[model samples]
Structures are given as C-alpha cells and as structure tokens.
Target: MRRILAIGGGGFTTEKEPSLVDAYIHRLIDKPRPRICFVATPSGDNRAQIDKFYEAYGSLDCEVSNLPFFNGWGPNVIPYTDFKPHLLSQDAIFVGGGHLRSALAVWREWGLDVAMKEAWNRGVLLAGMSAGAMCWFETALGGPFEQGNYGVQRGLGLLPGACAAHYHNAHVSERRVNLLAEMHRGLIPSTLAIDDFAAVLFEDQQLVKTVSWASTSTAYRVRQQNGCVEEAPLTAVPLQESLIV
Candidate 1:
C-alpha cells in the first residue's frame, strides 16, 4: 500500500539526539536493513542537515543515503540522470524541511516530483517534516508572504485537502489562526494541522492514524462550519510503545 508519514515538526534535523519518531519511521519499512534515502531539496541540500541525518541513522540497522539537488556542496550526489532509478530503489524517502515554495520549484525543474510520485505509488514509505509533510497534499499554508500574510499554496496533490505544519508552535503560532481563517473563508478545503513532534499517517491516501513522540504534540482536523471555523483534535498514539507498521 502507498504510505506517508507527514510530520508537523521535530525530527533528526531539529533534535541533537535521535528521537523515537525516527525509529518508528525505520520500523515502517519492514526491511531488516531498509534502504532509506534523504531528500534534502527543501533545505537546499544543506550539509549540516544532511550530516544530522547521518548522525541519527548511520548507527542504526538500516542503510542510509541522501539525494542532493543543489550543486557545489560536493557530497557524493547521485547524478541527475540517475535520480529516478536511485529514488525508486529505496524503501523509504525522507524529505527535510525548509523553504516550501522554492523547494517545489526546484523539484519540478529537476523532475524529482515525478519520481517521488512513482515512488509513492510503488509503496515506498514517503515521509518528511514541515515542508516535506505539506508537499504531499493538495494544498498547504504558505506564509509570511509580503507583510507577513499567509495564504494557500499548491502541493503535489498525492493526497486530498490541505495541510498546515507547526500549527501549535509558539514561534509560528499565527499558523493555527491563519489556517482556520483560510478554511473559514472557503479559500482552502478541510485541512490537517500537525504540531511539532506529531504526525498523521496515511495509507493509500486515507489517514490511518496519528502518532507522536512528545506528550504535548498532536494533530487536528480543521474546517468551516456554520460560517465559522471548527477544529477537532486527532487522537495520537505514543510512538514509544507501538510500532504501527
């Protein structure tokens, strides 16, 4: 089945120590030594972020590699001509977070978008945090645009509706408010709002469950109702206890 784990926040890049969430992602692959590839396009293939991935996964039982889109960093990047086959061979592809709009543009230009779609269809576990999470849905909240305005942004539409990441983060608390407003205004359809350290899992385009590594982390389903915004929490299971693969 096609699967996706869309994380709102918190991952190897955000934490110094490895998290249960990362381990949970590894378990989902069902391979004794899963071949997991990091897609760091959103972070412009930031070397620091890539290093964090290695730090977290290198000692694990799985095999780890990364596909870099940006050039000049010079880190054993797979050639552009080999991207399709290389991505398809992996058991999972984890995208890193960064500038969403710019990432999608570069992805489209490189035709990485098409390769990802194929990977998803082939049942490769597609997962990521923040921008990586939002890219799989139909629409996502794009923000701080021109005078700090937030609005709807297009996605690859692998799944329906919209997505909002960091919904409860104090640093970007406005995300929750703006997301509700957009849904209330009918500017975007029902959306999934995910907090830091929380993630919503999708199987074959249907949300199967929510899970989190942090106690306060959670997910929400928000939509317009009776001319007002309404939201309901999506119950999350603790990833430390169960392997929901």
Candidate 2:
C-alpha cells in the first residue's frame, strides 16, 4: 500500500498547480491537517535552496521536521535505535535533493534504505525530487562523475535499472548523455531519462503514470546491448499497462 511520488525537479509551485504541495501533504495526512517528517539534504549550503523547499511545503500547513545531512552524510549512522521509530512515527517521508551517491551510501550504512522499504511496505508515503528520485533506481547516470569518483556505484535498487535525471537539461551539455550511454552500454537495462518538471509515479511497485506541470519535459528510453544501441521517446508507449507487476 505504499504511495510514492517522484518529481524530476521543477514547477514545484505554480499557479495552475497550487495543490502540488498540498497533494503531498494530503497523501501524508489524508486529511486537512497532519504531521510528517521532512528529510532534506541540500548538496550545497545555499540559503536559497533551503528556503525554496521550506516555502513550497510550509504553505501547505504540514508539520515539517528538518533533518539535514551532516557533511553530506545523513542521520542513519548515529547508532541510535530510535532512528527507525522516529521515521515510522511519521505519516510520510520526503527526501530532498543532493549528491545521490553520498545520500545512498549514508542510507545503506545506517540501514535507512531498509527502514524506508519496511515503512513503505507498511503503507508509509515515500516521496522525493531530483537526486532523491534518482537514488531509488538500481543504477544512476553521471553519479560517479558528480562525485568525482570513477567506476560504477550501486544505487538503493528500489527500482531496477538505471535512471537519468535532468534528461533534457543534461543533454544540452552532451557529457551527461555520454555518461548515460556509457552506463547503458554496460550490463544495465534500458535507462530512464527524466526531464525537468516531469515525474513518473509508482504505487505498489508499479508505474502508474507520468506527470508534468508545464508539459515541457520529456523522457527517453535508451537501450544498448551487444554493440547495438536503440533509443526512443518514452511517451510513445503507455507506462501503466507496460510496467512489470
């Protein structure tokens, strides 16, 4: 009964979608008012980035608990048994953007990933944007480059295969697309390239739909195997009916 909302990172609050934040809040509380935990990790300590998230969700009247990562590490490694309980007590969990590799490493070190999967199994809401959304996949493109580290790094594996974030934006530079193509050339399955302001929602481990605030975003499905590469626009197919259940 887990509900997950993954956004590609844009149009968080717009005139036409005022309920974007409220929708998340309602998913957490299922009522007018509810208490929830806000797990945020901003890669850089920019006040603007921090305030933007606060303002977006704060307007919805949801109780937010800021849990910022320590030096890029999360609160999972504190050796406190109370960590799981504290997370479970909340109606939903919201993960903010940051370095995907660092976030997943910290989460795995402290069993945060395990806890989250357990919570999801128990019907807790799991939501994220950008890096947060990328971490859930089995593989992530450009993560090793972002961390300045070489070699393939494993992801949380919540979803099988690789995911490419900021698909259109990153493609502008070509480096990101090259990295993703390189990764796809390896053993990874077809990669999911998510454009900004778009998201693919999942429920019960099944993809439900793709949503966009401005309809400017797009997704690409790329597959390379045995020296043959194939790329196609993801929107041409229906996701809900095609997702493996």
The lDDT per prediction is 0.85, 0.60
Candidate 2 structure quality by residue, lDDT tens digits, 1-245: 76776656653422244534335435435755454555554354234444554555566766555454453232222223456877776677777676777667777776888988887778777777777677777776534443233224576677777777666775455635565556554645577777766677678767766765444565667777567766666552232233323
Give me the candidate number with maximum lDDT: 1
Count of clashes in candidate 1: 0
Model 2 residue runs over 4 Å out of place are 11-29, 42-48, 71-81, 142-151, 170-172, 225-228, 236-245
TM-score winner = 1
Residue 79 in model 2: shift from native, Å? Answer: 11
Candidate 1 displacement at residue 9 in angstroms: 0.2
Q: How many angstroms is residue 55 displaced in model 2 relative to the true structure, after the best TM-score fit? A: 2.2
Clashes of 2: 0
Tens digits of lDDT, candidate 1, 1-245: 99999999998989777788888888888679888888888888898988888778776776878888784243446676678998898899999899888888988988998999999999899999999999999997756533235657789999998898998998876677766665666766888989998999999999998998889889998888889888889999998776644
> How high a TM-score does candidate 2 get?
0.75
